[model samples]
Target: MPSLVDYIIYTFIKIDDSLNKILEEYDRPLRARVFKPKLSDSEVITMELIGELFGIDSTVGIWRYFNKHWT
Candidate 1:
């Protein structure tokens, strides 16, 4: 059986792939005044999911956790 981390990664990949497909189908035009974000929408969403899974209640907590554990 795959490890828990491996399973989590696989799930995240599937979610990200689905999100990309949906975005491609939508094909929404970008606002003229809005600049491109450094992080992709999928990436931000993945981080949010990770935070929730780990019971992180605040954005700052999420950032701190990621900084310590992810990076």
Candidate 2:
């Protein structure tokens, strides 16, 4: 069986190869904590999904939607 990282990497790449192309984009971005703790990738991905589905393009817009609906 694959390790957690292996599975996560495989699943992510399989789901969207463009995601891999964009992975380097976040390495230098500011990562702030929220909700008294850090949210997992699943939570972030959920917000991304909703945002993309609604044709939201900006990161700030996605965050605003998540804050409004997920609160």
**Model 1 ranges with Cα > 4 A deviation:** 29-34
Instruction: Give each prediction's root-mean-square deviation over alpha carbons.
Output: 2.7, 9.0
> Which number leads on lDDT?
1
Clashes in each model (backbone N, CA, C under 3 Å)? Answer: 0, 0
Q: What is candidate 2's TM-score against the reference?
A: 0.45
The estimated TM-scores of all candidates read: 0.70, 0.45
Clash pairs detected, candidate 2: none
Candidate 2 per-residue C-alpha lDDT over 3-59 given as tens digits, one digit per residue, 9 for 90 to 100: 754754565555455544566678653345554446655456656765776799988
lDDT scores of the candidates, listed in order:
0.75, 0.64
- Candidate 2 lDDT score at position 63: 94
Model 1 weakest 10-residue run by lDDT: 25-34
Candidate 1, 1-71: lDDT as tens digits: 99867865886798789887777766573323367877666667777787888899888898788779867
Candidate 2 clash figure, as a count: 0
Ten residues in a row with the worst lDDT in model 2? 28-37
